[model samples]
Target: MSSKRERRWWTEEEDQILKAGVESQSKQIGEVNSLMSWNEIAAMLPRRTNKDCRKRWYKVRSDFIKGTWSREEDRKLQQAVQQHGLKWALVSRDVESRNADQCAKRWQHGLRPDLKHTPWQPEEDAKLLQAMDKHGNKWKKIATLDLPNRSSHDIRNRQVLKQLF
Candidate 1:
C-alpha cells in the first residue's frame, strides 16, 4: 500500500473549526499586517496540508447557512412564516440560525399547518378527491376547504402517490 492516507469526509465539528479559523484570521488582519495562513489552519488538523484545509473549507461553504434546528427555532419559523406568508427573505432574517432556503424547506416540509403529520385514512382520501375535483390541484385552497389536519404539502404528496400507485 502507498504511504499516502485516503481522504475522508469532514465532520460538522471540523467544519465549525475551519470556519472559525477563516473568520478569526480575517478579523485579525486589520489589527496586524500578518494573518493566520492556511498553513496555520492545516497545522491544527491532523494529516491535512494547507491546500487540503483550504479546499475542504470551500467545499462545505454553503453549509455555513444550515446547522442544527431546535424546537424554539421551529416555533420562531412558524410564527415568522405565518406573519410574513411565504416571504423567505423576511422570515429568514427574523429567525436566526436559519437562512432563506432552510426556512422555506422547514415550512414546506413540516411546520406548515396545511401538512398533516399522520398517514392518510380512507375517509381523508375520499375528501381529498372531492376537494381536488372542486379546486383542481390548488392544494392550498383545497386544504382550507375541508381537511383540518391536512396541509397543502400533505395534499400534494397524497395526490402524487395516488397518481403513481
Candidate 2:
C-alpha cells in the first residue's frame, strides 16, 4: 500500500482557489435555507477544512468592514478630525463599519491625531475642586459641571482627586 502524505499549510494559490470557490458556491446557495455546510465547502477545496474556510470567511468579512488603515485612510481620518474637530466616533464609523474598538485604539495611540486629547486642564482641575468642595465626594455632580464633555465617573478616581482633597 502507498503511504499517505500529511496535510500541510495552505499556500497563496490555495487561498485564491478557496476564495473563488466560496464566491461561486455562495452565489449558487443564495437565499437557500440550510445552505452548504463548511464541511462541504472544505470537501470542494480538498486541501482545507470547514473550520479553515469559516475562519478565512470571517477574516475577510472583518477586513472588509474595518478596512485596514492605508495611508489614504489615515489621511482621511486626519482630515475628518480637522474638519469635524475630534469627533473620533464619527471618524471611526466612517473609516470602517466593523472593528470600532480597533479604530478607537488607533485613535487613542495618536495614530489618529485628529481625535480629541484627554489632558487634565487647569480650569478643569479648579472646577473639579470647587465642585468637590461644594458636594463633598459628590463626584458625579462635580464632573458634570467641571467637565461636561467628560464622563465624570471615570475622572473621580484619578490621582488629581488625592491632590485636590
Candidate 3:
C-alpha cells in the first residue's frame, strides 16, 4: 500500500504566507537556512512540506528575475565569462538580475564566440536526421558528438523546425 498527496498549484494566499514567513526569518537571522527554519515555516502551512516551502520561497522571492536579456546584460555576461571561466555563481554576480543558471545558459546558447550561427546546409540537416535516428532525442549527445558547433538548444529547435515543415 502507498499514499499520494494531492497535486495543485500554490494559491496566492499560500504564496503570501510563505513570503512573509521566509522574510521574517531572514530578517531575524540575516539569512534563512538549516532544516529548522523550513520545518517551522512548514508548520504554518499544514498541507506543505519543508521542501515545498523552500522551493516555493525561491520562486516567490523578489530577486527571482526573468524575461528577455538586454544587450548590456549580454556584455556583462561576456566579461564575467572571461573573468571567471564558467564559475557561474561568480559570473552571475557581474550580470545584474540573473542567477547562475541563467548566466550559464546565456553564455552556452548565445554568447559563446565560437557558436556557429550560419544557416544550416542540406548535408548538415541530413547529418542531424541520422544523429536523431541513432540517438533518439538526446540533443546534448547529438550536439556534442555529431554537431560540435551547435548547442543542444539549437539541435532541439532544429528538430522542431523539421517537424513543422
Candidate 4:
C-alpha cells in the first residue's frame, strides 16, 4: 500500500514567504515567468512539495472574490450579459467581484427572464422526495430529469429546509 501524506495547514508566516517568493519569481515585465519552476519555489518552504506550492499559489490568488452579490453587481451582470451574450469570462470581467462560474449561475438561476418562481406544491414535494431517493443527492440530475425549472442550488436548499439527508 502507498503511504498518504498527512495534510498540514500553512501558517501566516509560511503564506507570507510563499507570496513573496512567488511574486518575485512570477514578475517579469507584466506576465508570469515561464522559466521559474514550482520546484524552485517549493524549495524555499520546509516540507512542501512543488505540487503543493503550485496548488496553494492558485488557491490563495489575490483577485478571487466571494460573498453575497449586491444590486449594483446584479445591474453589472445584466449589462455584461447583454453586451457579451453568455461569454461568461468576458461577462465576469464586466461584473465586479464575480468569476465566470458565479456569473453563469447568477444568469441561469437568478437573473434568467423566464425562470419560474411558483411555490413548491405538495405534488412537487413528493416528487422531490422520490427523486432524492432515486438519485442520492445528485441535485442536478434530480433538478433536470425529475424537477423541471428547478436549479441544483434551489433543490439543495429545499432539501436542507426540509432536513432531509
lDDT of 2 by residue, 1-165 (tens): 759657687778777877776777778877211254667768767767776776565455535455466776667666656666555445554655433344544554445433224777787667776777778776557645655554544456653556676
In candidate 3, stretches whose alpha carbon ends up further than 4 angstroms from where it belongs are 1-58
Candidate 1 Cα outliers beyond 4 Å, as residue runs: 1-91, 112-115
lDDT of 1 by residue, 63-98 (tens): 434557888899889889878989876787678666
Writing each residue's lDDT as its tens digit, candidate 4 over 1-165 gives 759998799999889988877878868534333344679889999899987876676567667566688999999999999999998767877885776677888888788765557787888789999998899899989978987677777888888988953
Candidate 4 off by > 4 Å: 1-65
Better of 2 and 4 by TM-score: 4
* Better-scoring candidate (TM-score), 1 or 3: 3
TM-score of each: 0.45, 0.30, 0.68, 0.59
Using TM-score as the measure, the top candidate is: 3
Question: What lDDT, from 0 to 1, does candidate 2 have?
Answer: 0.59
> Model 2, stretches more than 4 Å misplaced?
1-8, 31-36, 61-165
Model 1, residue 23: C-alpha shift (Å):
18
- How far residue 54's Cα lies from its native spot in candidate 4, in Å, is 11
Q: What is the descending lDDT order? A: 3, 4, 1, 2
The better candidate by lDDT, 1 or 4, is 4
Each prediction's Cα lDDT score?
Answer: 0.75, 0.59, 0.83, 0.79
